[model samples]
Target: MSANASANSFQALVRLLRYARGYRRRIVAATTCSVINKIFDIAPEILIGVAIDVVVNQEHSFVARIGFTTPQEQIVVLAVLTFFIWAGESIFEYLYKILWRNLAQRLQADMRLDTYEHAQRLDMAYFESKSSGQLVATMNDDVNQLERFLDGGANSLIQVGVTVVAVGAVFFVISPLIALLAFTPIPLIIWGAFFFQRKAGPLYADVREKVGDLASRLSNNLSGIATIKSFTSEAREAERLRSVSEAYVEANRRAIQVSSAFIPVIRMAILAGFLATFTVGGMLALRGDLNVGAYGVLVFLTQRLLWPLTGLAEVIDLFERAMASTRRILDLLAVPVTVKDNEGKPLAEPVRGEVSFDAVSFRYAASGVGVESVSLHVPAGNTLALVGATGSGKSTLMKLLLRFYDPQAGRVCIDGQPIGEVSLASLRQAIGLVSQDVYLFEGSIRDNIAYGRPEASEAEVIEAARTAEAWEFIQALPQGLDTAVGERGVRLSGGQRQRLSLARALLKDPPILVLDEATSAVDNETEAAIQRSLAKIGHGRTVIMIAHRLSTIVHADEIVVIDGGRVAEQGTHAGLLEKGGRYAAQWRVQTGAMEESEALG
Candidate 1:
């Protein structure tokens, strides 16, 4: 990796460690267990040295210095202490495992939930720019990577530090000379571990990015498989996917190259430390400055302390990868929601569905291009139709009214109250919407209909379906209301999906209704049935309908023709035709279709 990439990885680690603030207690407990375990594990080496002294020096051994006086009894004491040390090591190992694993699981669950909740609260504009698979990869795959690291690598890292500190103290007390020799290589080992991390971290991060891209491509392709096959573009898509896969593989391989070199380099450092300690300590024993047993213990302890350092590279690698994922997860959680509830008095009474937009303007975040000042009104118990060519800001108007994106200028009002001053939940509750691009969850027909009103009774659901003119087709299904609608309602026809969307709105029964090209995809027969249902539902309710089909809105109580984001004309259908303007031109084209239908009839 380049120097900039290495620096970025370090910054990512710093950001990630900040998220563990909430897990401080667990981390402390786990670290304590790891330290205690290493302390106990170092005791066995001391015992081995004691056995050597008992056999060689007998009563004059160092065991006599502790008042054991007899070699046989000293052996017994050493045996019991060895058992206790091993047992204590085992107990702390268990404690560390339990604590670290629980911590890992808890952090994973909390982070995933928080990320998902934050994503939900974000503005719709953010979702428009992001892919579902990329978000899923962050929430699942990246989080799982962190959890796997915490499950073992965290404890290993803590234990390695404990080993170095505790064993270093022992070696110093025994013989500072040999301790210096053994400790000489530790700095080099640590430096090598860090050097490897600096190289591998960016490679792992790139690997993760490549995986996210691959997931996005797979998800998009699968969702559009029908179109791909229709156009015979399967081979092209496969080749594209292969290229992405190869990029991911190559990134991982680069990381492996650096990671694979870590252990061998670390092993050489350990060898240097080991040989220095062994040769020097043995020569000193021969010079009568150190006893045979003491020399034995020093050799065994040096190996016990330094051998584990060889595995430090692997643990650091895990840490680096986990830190990369953690940074992404934290960044997601840190994204502030631009759209939030306003602090205002709650509505005491139900809304009357009076909607008014006073010179509202909006621009998408990506392009900074938007509609200019525009205004319209729909009083209670009235219907308003918006007709325009594409890009004339028809849909943007609906989004502003719904508070999906607040307008940069002017105000949107509901029942005489500016929507910006009202709680978002209560404001949305007062309105119902049905769009042409209908979405249905993977569930039974009844569930899809009752989605907006989950607590609605079965009878109420059935009644709503009947009002939407969907009950006839629903009852014809294999399981009546219980029939499964596959993912996004794929099992249902386009017309059926529209009816289900209408049923959902009827169930909501909000005083304000929006139909944005709701009947655009259905056949003439289905459209006629839906139009009849809309007529019944629109009575005494405020309705705003946007449509390219002029016939759908010719009977609306009032029509507002939008051109270039401004209201160009406002009148009933007949008034517009008499005026011989844009509305009339659109009406002429639609009426031509009607004339052809009549001739066929």
Candidate 2:
């Protein structure tokens, strides 16, 4: 790896460690167990050397020097020590495996939850710019990648380190000349692992990106299945899916090619080290310069030390893959939150829904299409309607009031208090919104209605449904309010879903209600029913309506015509028609079209 890339990888590891600081005690315990187990694991090789000395050297053996005089006694003592070593290895192996695997499970779960919650609080603009599938990939696939490494790769690396250090110490003490020749190839193997890492890192990163693109294509196709079928484009969609899947496969193939070449090169390097120790130690023992038993220990320990280095290629592959995923997850957590909720006081109690837009201006960064300097106000209990052509910024005004996007140039106030100065939870709780693009959760009719107030009594849910003129249709279903809504309410008609959305907002019973083309999806009869209900319910609460249907807002206490993000006109319905401006021109066109349809009928 380049020095810079290596530094960044180290930084990522450090950041990850800091993130998992809560599990430090468990990490320490697991690591200690792994080291101790590896020490015991290498003891059997040394025992074989001691057993040979007992059989060949008899009273002159190393064990005899330790006070076991007879060859049979030395052999018996060696057997007992070997048994205890193997048992210790087994016990600590179990302890480390369980500890590492449990830590992996817990850390992954906590990281996913924290990342999801942070994503939820980000501003609407952030979501608009990102795809849902990419977010899902990070939360699920990327997090699982880190978990897999922790499950086994971490233990393998720890043991490899302990093996090299413990075996190298024994080699140098027995015969420094053999140890020097045997360890000569160690630097070359270490360099090769890093060389493969530098080459494979970018390839693995490409593999991860392809996975996200494949996920995005699948998510979009599944959500729009009805459209594809209606157009009879199933074959085309299938081909598109195949293309993305193939790209993912190609990316993985490239990464595998690079990682696969590392092991063969590493195996050759390991052979050089083992041969050096075997030939040199044998020559020394023949010359009587090295003890025979010590020469035997060197031969066995050489293989034990060098063979594990061959597995380094696999361990490095896992490490690089996991570090790629870790960087993605951490990048998501670092996204700046533009709409911060930390610096505001709670909105005052008994929020009287007096709302004002004071010379407000907000333009979307991507499209530069938004409201200009617009100003208006609604009294605490009055009804105000907004009328505009498509893309004229009528909805933008409402978004500003909700603080979905703060105005770039001016202030939005509710109950005479600047909304940006109030806590987001209190500000949003004070207003209820029922938008034209209605969404229903996959659950019962009663659950959707009571979503805004889950603890509401059954009687209250029924009443809210009745007020929205939805109770009759709900009752016609076999399960009444208990009937399932399926995904995004696919089981219900468009009109039925719209009413349920309204019912949900009504149940919240906020002091202010905003309806953005709320009745646009319903039939004429249902629209009339909802209109009548609105008349009854609009008595005391403030209502802000955005409508393309001019007839729906004729009875509003005041009507404002928005043109190019500015207020073109404002007055009561009768007064605006008398003025004969933009509002009058649109009213004439809509009413004339209705009259001609009536005459034809």
Candidate 3:
């Protein structure tokens, strides 16, 4: 891994640990259990030394020095203490396992939920630059990595620390000279860990990026399966996916190559420590300076201390991978939310639904994309149609009204109150939107229609469906309202999906409605049927419709012609046509083409 990436990853882990402050109590309890468990676990080695002393030295053993007085009574006392030591080790093991695992589960759930909620709160501009698959990877795969670490890494780290502290104290007390030799290799092992971490961090981050790319490809392909099949590009897409999958595998292999070298180097260091302790302690025993039993205890404790250091490779590998994911997840959490809730007074229940755009101007960060200074107003219970060529700021106006992205200049108002001064949720709640690009989740038709108002009754859903002219086809389905719509409602026709969206908006029954090219995708016959439904639905509601087909909205109360983000013309449809301006020219061109197509047919 590069130095810059390693530093970034380290910072990410610090942030993640900070976020985990809420789990401090659980972490402390788990760490305490792990330490206590290791302490008791090392007691058996001490017991072995005591047993050796009892057998080899009779009444003059270390037990007698501690005032036991008799070999037989000392043996009985040692046996009882050994039993309790083993039992205590087992008890703490259970406690650590339960605490750590539960902590992992709770932390994973909280991180996933919080990430998703934050993602939803982010502005549309953020989403435009990121893929759905990348977001999903952060919420699911990244979080699962952290959970895996917490599940085992927590206990392993604590135990490693406990082993060092507990065993180092004993070695120092028993024989400081030998302890120096045994502790010499520990610094080298720690150095190896940092080196491995530096090399592996970037590789793991690359692996995460590759996985997100692979997921993005799969998600895009699956969503566009119909297009792929129609174009007969299955082989092409399969090859593309194979390339992405192979990239992911190569990324992981790079990380594995670096991580795989860590254990061997660590083992070499451990072996040096073990052999040093063994030879020095044995020499001390022979010189009568340290008892044979003490030498036995040194051998056992040395193995207990050094062997677990080999497992450090596995724990460090988990830590590095988790920290990589932690960085991505935390970075997402750190993305500054440009749009926030307004601390303004709430709109009264009986809002008039009047909307106004005062000199609004917006330019996307990318080139050749923007809406210039624009102004317009639609009174309550009136319908306004926005007509223009593609890229004429027609749709951008709707986005501004919905507060998806606030205009860089000028103000938007709802019911005479500046939208900037109205709480976002309350302002949005007063408006219902149905866009040209309809999206429906995999669920029954009834459920999709009632998405905004889940508590709405089945009768209310059916009524909305009827008003949207969707009830006839819905009832004709095999299971009526209960029929499952495949993923993204792939099972339904495009027109059917749009109707369902309309039904959803109708169910919401907001005071203001914005339909941005809502009927553009449907055929003329279906469009006429939808228009008939809209006529009745728009009565006494503030409706703003954006349409490329002028014929569908000719009856609208007012028509505003938008060109290059400016209001070129504004009046009733008939009045605009009489003025022979931009609106009249667009209408003539569209109607003339329709007549030509009809003649040709």
Best by TM-score: 3
Q: After superposition, how far is residue 10 of candidate 1 from its true place, in Å?
A: 4.5
lDDT of each: 0.88, 0.89, 0.90
Pick out the ten consecutive residues of candidate 1 with the lowest summed lDDT. 342-351
Off by over 4 Å in 2: 1-5
lDDT of 1 by residue, 352-459 (tens): 888899988887878765567888878888999999898788888999888889999999988888888888878888888999899999999999999989999999
lDDT of 2 by residue, 1-601 (tens): 4564455566778889988899999999999999999999999999998888788899999999999999999999999999999999999999999999999999999999989999988888988998888889889999999999899888999999999899999988888899898888889988998887787787777787888888889999998999999999999999999999999999999989988998899888889988888888888889989888898898899888988988888897888788878888998999988876744598888898999999899999998899988989999989999999888998888888888888999899998899999888898888989899989999999999999899999999999999988999999999999999999999999889988988999999989999998887778887887788788778899999998888899999999999888889999999999999999999999999999999999
1 or 2: which has the higher lDDT? 2
Deviation in angstroms for 288 in model 3? Answer: 1.0
Alpha carbon lDDT at 501, candidate 3: 94
lDDT by residue (1-601, candidate 3, tens digit) is 3677668767987798799999899989999998999999999998898799898998899899888889998999999999999999999999999999999999999999999999988999999999999998989999999999999986897799889889999989888988899989999988888888888888898998998998899999998998999999999999999999999999999999999999999999999999999998998898899988888888899888888988788888898889999988988998988877775666666888898999999988865566888888899999999988889899998998888898999999888888877788888879999999999998899889999999999999999999999999998999999999988888999899999999999999999999999989988767987898899888899999999999988999899888887888899988998999988888889999999999999
Two-way lDDT contest, 1 vs 3, winner: 3
Q: What are the runs in model 1 whose C-alpha is more than 4 Å off?
A: 1-10, 343-345, 597-601
For every model shown, what is its TM-score relative to the native structure? 0.96, 0.97, 0.98
